[model samples]
Target: MKSKHLILIFLLIVSAKSRAQTNHQTIEVAQVDSKKNNCVEIPSTFSHEILSESKSLNALKSKKIRRVELIYTRYKENADFDQNQLNEDRMSRLNQLLPKLQIDKPEIVWIEQIGATTSTDAKNYFHGFRIYTDVAPVARTYQRTHLNDLANPAVDFLIDNTIGGTFSHPSGTQIHIPANAVIYDNGKPVFGKYTISYSEYRNAAEILFSGLPMEFKDKTGSYLFNSAGMYEIRGTKDGQTLALQKDLSIDFNCTKNEAGVNFYEMNDQTGEWNLLKSDLFSANNPNETPSAKPEIMSANSEQRIKRGVAPDNYETEGSSKVYQQLNLVYGLISSKFGVYNCDQIFRIANKTIISPKYLDVSSKKPIKNQNMICLIDKDVNASFSFGVKQITCNSQGENIFLLFTEDGEIYALKSEKDKRVNLNQKEPEFLMENITNKVKTSDDLKSYLNI
Candidate 1:
């Protein structure tokens, strides 16, 4: 009955669109968001940078063989999730799994973002996750603790997105999901095996959830059964009563079996997902839902991390090493963690700071340095420069500096372009002897010059 109504609703929605007059410009299809328009044409400034980082990170992420970790939750979540490898042991095992499975390691890690509610307060949402690894998607063995709660409500969850294309799922998907019931941390009306249903059976896929309660509003709750054969329960003051603005945590899981492509799962807690087949998906998006791929939501999600830095689904491709360094710093600042240390790699050349005299006279100097430093490539195609207040560089250049102050004053080092040197245990030789203090109050060239 729900499926019939959903189909009718889908038909009605489509019929309404078809009935509209075609003569006028209709918002139904004529709408083009600024982001799409902007993103389509990569900003010239970031064009090279994005492509470069994209290629570099792609190489690292798109290895021929790969293994990935899947984080699942007992607190209902989606089948496919996008997450990164944070644990060193987990990462090593994944790196090794490819060879054992005779398949390439994974280019992406599928996390099963789950919802949690500790026994301490079924009403309160707890930030917790249970991790597992899907060996070439063949089988899954959980890492660390494996706890599935049936009584407590979930506070977090996920959505399995099917990237639309030739490689995507056809018609729909089927999942042979594994779930158990229990109550952790404890207060619930009852504790036993409850039925699990899929949203597809309810026809609620591609829809947004709203009108949720703030916390556990009441002792009783209602389990909403969707057209997809999945049961979604909402805790309320009463079974029939509804609470607006009350946030409820969900514990869920689902499976998606694509024809001829093997099976995959969306773990409810860990946010880790993967393919059950011995294959690597070079073209897969963990964030996009199977039914609808929303661009705005993708942009806003912190889950789309740029490698190890930003959360997967929330970032763009960049140097993973650089991002790792930044992550350490950010972690310390936001969390209770203390100061973080980062490593930087430098590229050296024959000269520490290339002198204009090293080049042949070509009328137009490849690099020009006056007040600020301009480190230009010998070919003059790429250049990087840093200054007192602003940093402007050619699209191909990478700036390795920290902007400590918003005003951009007092650099940790004399910020300049042509800075390809890294300072560590071994310091490269600099032409500092020519660094004559030229702070002349008289404002003369000689007075201002540091010889």
Candidate 2:
């Protein structure tokens, strides 16, 4: 009797334990069904909130409706997700599979721009387009950190962009595309490329963003996709959001007529860019070609060329006469200034001192012993002579100089075209200054002259 009782007790205990295990499994399955599946889901409440917050909807006359349609043609054909799976909790499994995937909620959305373009044509037509996106905050952060890492493909595959990559299942396969390939969000034509591959995917598409119309209240706006798979993006011409202003720092060389300096860029009459030949001053060109290129100094330190004239040969049969006039001016100035340093001499010989001032041959010779100086304009085209209250003037001819005195007498460098020098009749202008009493060394002279 005792043995039989013990056996009965053991079987009862085993039966109860088995029932408990089965109940546990059933509860687990039920819990899985109750929890959410997709990481991001937009319910009707979110849709209503977005509409109200965006203030793009109206109930009055004609309710202009804009919506984002997730053409699920590819998803239905390629994805193996069951109807139940769309609403089931897969975060636990996804977390195990992809440790990098960290975003709490990620959803597909659309960004639209109204009056996004201004016509360069005659009509000045305005156009606009829509952009689709599936980028999440966490995923954006991860991409920044691990741009080149392919180790966690699941992070990019699942949460970042569900519509991207090869979606393979028993039914069919949807090949992953470059973001640029997804140009057409719905039926509207977007401006730039929409590419989303393993390499890079920019969710925002830059169209004619600069000239968006001012009447469009929200020139650029975003809309969330409702769980029902529709996102209404309303864009109206009320008042526009300005496109971002940019301060661009771009570097470019200005057009300069430096005689011997090689100009790499030149514009023609029709405004087409052209480059002068490198061997413009080669010795081979004995024939004076009318199309003869301007002379440029060679790279050689020993050989120097100035305005098509070489150092060894100052005058040639058909060289520029401007050089001859400049040489004459240089000799006169050097003789009066007690010989400038080599650099100053080079600057003068190069015809670099704003163009040489020519004495008006028509005007009568001026009285001698007057305080005067030659002034060259910033532009090398014109020059002049000016009478001043006995102040020194530097001859570099690059910058203008000013002189002031306690007696309220102000003298400035004269840059008018008509002020000419009579090289033959008058002394060199550099020597006319009150040198003995007022002028000092070259430094003091430069300071007084204000080169």
- Expressed as tens digits, the lDDT of each residue in 296-337 for candidate 2 is 322222333433232433422221211221111010011010
Candidate 2 clash total? 16
Query: In model 1, which runs have C-alpha deviations exceeding 4 angstroms?
Result: 1-417, 422-451
On the 0 to 100 scale, the lDDT of residue 85 in model 2 is: 28
Give me the overall lDDT of model 1. 0.22
Stretches > 4 Å off in candidate 2: 1-252, 255-410, 413-419, 423-451
TM-scores of all predicted structures: 0.15, 0.13
List the global CA lDDT of all models: 0.22, 0.22
lDDT of each residue in 1-451, candidate 1, tens digit only: 9999999999997776445321211111111111211011111110011111122222333333233222322332233422221222233343343233235323333233222333332123212111223221111111011111101121212222121111000112111112222112122322332222222111111111111111111124311111111222222222222211212111111222122221223332232322222211113413222343222222123322221123322222221111112101001111110111111112333323221121112332322222233232322211233332222232233322211112211111232446643432122222221212222111221122210
Best by TM-score: 1
